[model samples]
Target: MNKIAIIAACFIAPILILVTMGIMYWVNHNTLVKLDVACDSQFAEIDNMLKRRADLLPNLVNTVKGYAKHEKEIFVAVAEARTKIGSAKTVKEKSLASSMMDKALGRLLVVVEKYPDLKANQNFIRLQDELTGTENRIAVARTRYNEAVKKYNTKIRSFIGRLVAGGMGLEKRDFFEIENPEDKEVPKVDFES
Candidate 1:
């Protein structure tokens, strides 16, 4: 009877340890996955707002063009920046492209200042309002994305999470960080020219 009890104890101890380890690994992995998904979803929202802004830009440029026909260079630059936004893939690339768009749009607005009539045009007013709202949405989405990245990075760097992440081949995600200090400022929209 004593021998049988000893054999049973030896078998059950390893099984219990293995179950506990498996559960711990699973819980950690699931948390990491959830955080990763949240980051992706937030990035998608940013992308959507960018596309919305991009779509509005052409109309805004065209409306301004009717008033200032000789301003070909600025229009071309805005178009190029808009193209970059579409072509950008990675988070960093998208951020830089967005900055380019902001700069181009800023230059375009400078041209708008030269013609006060364009400022009061109904179409221009509507497009400007839409772009402004879209920019705000982009800012909100970017903040959310960065927050998600912070949480995810914190988790992966944690003691147990590091082991689980490394074992599962998970990597750290990039935050939607501003590469240029100038890009931190929202493009000013002063229609009072």
Candidate 2:
């Protein structure tokens, strides 16, 4: 009886430790993966919002063109930026394209400000309001994405978490950061009357 009890205890001890470790690893790994997915989804939402803004820009440009045909250069710039945004393939590329479009659109707005008629046009005003709202949403989504990424990255770098991430073949993801010279400068909008 004594020998049997000793044998049982010896076998069960290592098994219990292994089970506990496995459960801990699994829970931690799952949590990190969830965070990563949240980050990715938020970024996708931001991208979609940017695309929506870009889609609206062409119509806005065309409407302004009807009122101000002489501003051909600004119109062409807006068109080119929109095209670049549409063609963007990666997150980084999309960020650059968005920045470019912002600059072009700012220039267009400045030009539009010169013509009081364009500013007062019902369609133009409505589109402008919509675009502003979309931009605000994009900004909020970006903030959320950054927070999720920070949490995920912190977990990935932790000792045991790093081991688990490596075992799962998870790699670090890059944020959609814009560090270009053009992105650094605020879009010049000469609203001077």
Indicate which candidate wins on lDDT. 1
lDDT of 1 by residue, 87-114 (tens): 9999999999898998899899889989
Worst 10 residues of 1 by lDDT: 184-193
Candidate 1: residue pairs that collide: none
Worst 10 residues of 2 by lDDT: 184-193
Q: What's the lDDT for residue 68 in model 1?
A: 95
Question: Model 1 misses residue 93 by how many Å?
Answer: 0.6
Clashes of each: 0, 0
- True-structure RMSD for candidate 1: 2.9
Top candidate when judged by TM-score against the true structure: 1
The whole-model C-alpha lDDT of candidate 1 against the native structure comes to 0.92
Model 2 RMSD in Å is 2.5
